[model samples]
Target: MKNNNSICFISFFFLFMFMLMNMVFMLYFLMNNMILVLEWEIISFNSMNIVFSILIDWMSLVFMMFVSLISSSVIFYSKSYMSSELNLNRFIMLVLLFVFSMMLLIISPNIISIFLGWDGLGLVSYCLVIYYQNIKSYNAGMLTVMSNRIGDVMLLMVIAWTMNYGSWNYVFYTELMKDDFSMEVISGLIILGAMTKSAQIPFSSWLPAAMAAPTPVSALVHSSTLVTAGVYLLIRFNNLLMSTDFILLLLLISGLTMFMAGISANYEYDLKKIIALSTLSQLGLMMSILSMGFKDLAFFHLLTHAMFKALLFMCAGMIIHMMNDNQDIRYMGGMSLYIPVTSLCMNISNLALCGIPFLAGFYSSDLILEMVSMSNMNMLIFFLYYFSTGLTMFYTMRMLMYLMVNEFNLMSVYCLYDEDFVMLKSMIMLLLMSVVSGSFLIWMIFSYPYMIYLPLNLKLMVIYVVIMGGLLGYLMSMMNLYSVNKFIMTYKLSNYLWLMWFMPSLSTYGLNYKFLNLGQNLMKNIDLGWSEFYSGQGMFFILKKYSIIFNIFQMNNFKIYLYSFVLWMLFLVMFMLMMI
Candidate 1:
């Protein structure tokens, strides 16, 4: 009864958000029509061009559709997924907030608007992750907050640099044409920010750790917005991205990241973490496509990846929830026979993930591989893509075989009804799309006789490679060679392989330690040549750090407000004085 009530409440909230989005879209359209109907001679073509440029268009609409689609499915999926949990109203509210922020992120006209939405989404995601208030959820939520802040800081720096050089346009490509600046520096900073958001190398561990959140969080984060923020940034600023030699950076780093993450996924015992790592690896593949000068292909991959990965996570959720919250695959064998629908859907999606032709992953991944093939084929990129494809199959089969095929000692037994109808329905939707649209979309995106750009008939060659790779991995699983490919086994000698080494993870503890140490050791003495701001002794340190503090007119409980007021006053005073 409570479950039914909760669903009704959340469904209402979902309706509210949808109505609001439609209202915004309608208002925008109305305003556009009004302007057109007025026949205003005052509206110059150049002025209209500027206004229209700021409006969200087809590309933004594409992302917006993804946001709405994934969010609605999650809302329905959550009816059963969270049915037994408490604080249900708050969860529903947060879901609304999550959807709102994602929609805002795409439609944002300026960098400021984008970051506002970005931080809002990040904040809501943190709350959702920690909603259960368990230790793992709390820790994971805190880490997400900190890592997202790091990305935010880099973005602020980009904004500052662009404002200085290109007049605060905030239209992404405006800065690309600025010849006075070093393209390398700007592109480097932008890519650095993208890497953090996308969970690229050295930063990849945070994503898998994020599995401590609910399965729905994992689904959305991996599929649509949070991780894709970086890719979206790169795509939006394609001109700037194209300016840097960073294409190689994206290629080599993304390929290596994919290989490393794929290897680590094999070691993951948690079902969600396994898929989480696969998410990271798959994003790396998309990034590899982005780096290969195939922006549209990358976006197509992003679209399909969102569908299939969300399906995988939702299925994983149903399985875990049914097994009474036991997520370890080792403990999950012989259950596939028990949950036929889940097993079938999961198998098909996992096969799609392994790039089985006629499935979603096959077409998009083939485009990426073909791009990699034509571009000065680095043997390493070639081998890594192939090897990752093989491993994708191996681990996916490992998951299927362990859950459905093998006989293992039961860890804990419980009888679960087939996943709720709503959850099952969503999974079915994803499954059908993953299977049918893969080929159709591929043909739509690329020319039919891809033979002109691709030797050996690109589509056929891709199908062949995928089959070969999946078969190799499947055979390897049968032979039990999967253990050797796991990252923990590969990295045993590193000794420092604990999850804390992840930059996002380390940044959490590292900030506390760094600030604490800095607070303890003040600069007492300095060479005169190195310090023009210094007075004798340590007086300079006080002045340097507290200059803004000295000018404050108010001291109160609200530190932030007081600081903002004082800063505003200072700006006002300066302006008035300058006018005189």
Candidate 2:
């Protein structure tokens, strides 16, 4: 126990120190407008230089700072959260490995090195997701890893394609190759990879499924390390992507993903999965804005979102811990009456998520909606952006009502309190950042404020939608058990919404059923039937039958011997005649 505590403290201290260092470096780089690239050539063959390269700039440094801060806090929180686990040391090591991989991904300018980090993130996250060693965790881990594998394959394709340029340092080529057809293809491949990593539309199922991981892992992976890896990669490649029609494809996919996640979150009952869906929705928002060539805004939102989302997960973890691992929101009610501090943190983060005025989320999400209004886009996209935004508020408010306002639904004898200082400390840190990080990032990232020229209705549209969504959320949550069951009346629609439009089923059984059935048929007809008959068992049967028949013939030893002797005598006589 002492050893485990020491390990946790050691890791937390180092990560915190590194976070401060990164913050200082980030400020320096932002002030001076400088980028530092450190390169080491591994090999030179056929004019292609295989080099390991690191890029140090404001963007990477700021991201590193945030990642380090979140990771350190999670580690510290885990000391209490995972204290009963025997292999706590292994968990810490895996988390450290995950953070290291993320750092590698953040700092690398070379795609090869980036791939090393990308693959590490996938593998390590799989380990974390299955940390509980249960069937659900195993299934979720498989889904998470397999979904990420698609992105890995895409990245491998990108690495192979970039070899044509004689160098895998994409930093050197993203701008120069913008007009090249091959580069456009590479950009598409990169988008596909990012989609899987960030959990875009088709790839979005894994994000919610991945909530089977421990809450600390959820806080780290969903917030900064794993899912955001895709968004960060896209941010890096924004120049190449913005130059082509692929941006439009990204735009459409991201918008749909945002809407799907928002709607799914509202229907979800599991607390962690609801939060995971919200993460998915936010990721969609980031990707959507980035597609529209607002990389800075996307990044700003990413950072701010990370702060609050991590805090939200930590608060959820605390609540779950107090609830004795029951994650169902239906059993949670009037939590603020018991664990006021945690409930306060949760509410603040939720409000931030809903883009409440002056909150961290508001700074980025509001700006994004405003920018969307200003841009020249069709009505469909416009509707998606605002509707998804409304859905975000709706789900958040609904969740809050279930957790804070409704009558207490748990057993009367249960113990729920906010006395865990370790957890509280971490949550408070993130809570502070979630409050201030947005405005701070805006000042740091942009040289000039965005000019908004909008009509009165357009300016108030966000407020109107949020208010409407909140009202609907409250009304929905207020429904009584004796009241009519709306889901029963709209069974199909409810099921569709509750199941994330059947995305998980589609990604899993929907995709694998036919192939699995084909494999079963092949095994039966080919390996078990035809191949067994023609080659294996049939050949053995034939050989055994012939051997038995020959044995039976040989059993008549006297007749066999007489026949052989006659044949020999005839042969001898014929040979003598010929010789004569």
Candidate 3:
């Protein structure tokens, strides 16, 4: 127990110190407009050079600061959250390793170094996901690792392709190779890799499945390390991905991902899964705007989202802990009555997620929306943008309703309180950031404010959508058991929405069954039947027949030996005559 406490304390101290140092450097670089690159050549083969490179600039520093802050808070929170667990030290180490990998990824401009960090993030996250020893954790770990392996392979291809440019450092070649076919392939592959990492559309199931990990892991993964790695990579590669067709495709895919996640969150009942889906929805928002060339806006939102999302997860963790590990929203209600402080934190984070006025999410999300409206995009994209925004509010309101307004459905004897000061302290720190980080970031990141010339109705559209979505969510939450169940009447539609449009099924059973069945048939017919008979069992039979014939010769050993001696002497005499 003392050992675990010491490890957590030491980690928190060092991470917090680093966060402070990075923030100072971020401000200094931002003010000076300075970028420092430190490089050391590892090997030179012909024209290709592999160098270990680190980029120190405002962007990297700011991101590192935020990552360190969140990591420190998560570590401190885990001091209480995982207190009773036997392997708290191991958990802390895994989290630290995750942080280290993220840092490596943030500072590298070289694709080779980026891949080192990228692969490290994937490997460490798999360990963290399956930290708990259980079948569900094991399965989730497999899904997470396998999904990320696609990205890893894509990055390896990128490394191979980038060799044509005579260096592994893509930062120098992005503009140079902009019009080249190799650049196009690299851009496409990078986008695919980012898609899997960020849990966009087809690769999204693993995000929710990953909730089987410990809550601290969830907070860190959803916020900074695993998922955001993709967005950060795209931010770095934004220069090369400016092709028209690529942007259009990314816009379509990311928009669909946003819509799918928002709708899925509304239908979800698990507390953690709802938050995880919200993370997915927000990631989609970031990717979509990034595709439209608003990389700065995307990055701004990424940092702010990290703040509140981490706070949100911490609050959720406290609630789940108090609820005796029950994750179902149906079993939780009136939590605000007991754990008011935690509830306040949850509400603040939830509102920030909804992009309520003056919060962390509002700054970036509102700007992204307004920018989309200003663009000459088609009606489909416009509809997806507004409708998805409303869905965000819709699900947020619905979740808050169940958590704060509905009757408490747990056992009567339970005691729930915000007595854990360690957890509360961390939540409070993030809560303050959630409230002010948006405005703070706006001033820091943008040199000039955006000018809007929208008419009245167009400007009010966001407000109208928010109100309508909230009202609908409230009405849905008010439905009684005696009332007609609309979901029961429309089973297929409800199930489709509930199951994330059958994406998880498509990713798992839909994709696996045919291949699994083929393997089974091959094992039975080829491996077990034909190959076994021709190789192992058939060879055994032939060897046994030969052995029996040899045994028969050995049975009459004395007579056979005498005949062999006479034959040998006659053969020797014949050989000698021939030689003469």
- The whole-model lDDT of each prediction reads 0.71, 0.92, 0.91
Indicate the residue-level lDDT of 529 in model 2: 90
Location of the lowest summed lDDT over 10 successive residues in candidate 3 = 507-516
TM accuracy, model 2: 0.90
**What TM-score goes with each of the models?**
0.77, 0.90, 0.90
**lDDT by residue for model 1 (1-580), tens:** 5766666456746654664575466446534542211111334585342222233554565566556667767777777677776666667668778877777667655676667777887798788778777998888777777667777888788777766654444555555454645566667777888887898876675687678877876787789878988888787767667766877877888888888777666556788988987888888888877877777788878878888898899999988887778888777776676788888888888888888767888778876777666777767888887777766766776677667777744554557575578788768867887787567556644543554276666436555655665565455445555645563465854334334134454555676347545655544233433343455645777776687565553354478787888999999999999999
Candidate 1 wrongly placed segments (more than 4 Å): 1-54, 165-167, 172-178, 411-413, 439-580
lDDT of 2 by residue, 116-196 (tens): 999999999999999999999998898888889889999999999998888888998788897788977899999999999
Task: Report the CA-based lDDT of candidate 1 relative to the real structure.
Answer: 0.71
lDDT of 2 at 18: 99
Flag the better candidate by TM-score, 1 or 3: 3
lDDT of model 2 at position 51? 71
Q: Residue 66, candidate 1: how far off, in angstroms? A: 1.8
- In model 2, state the lDDT of residue 359: 91
The reply for model 3, stretches above 4 Å from the true place, is 43-50, 482-484, 512-580
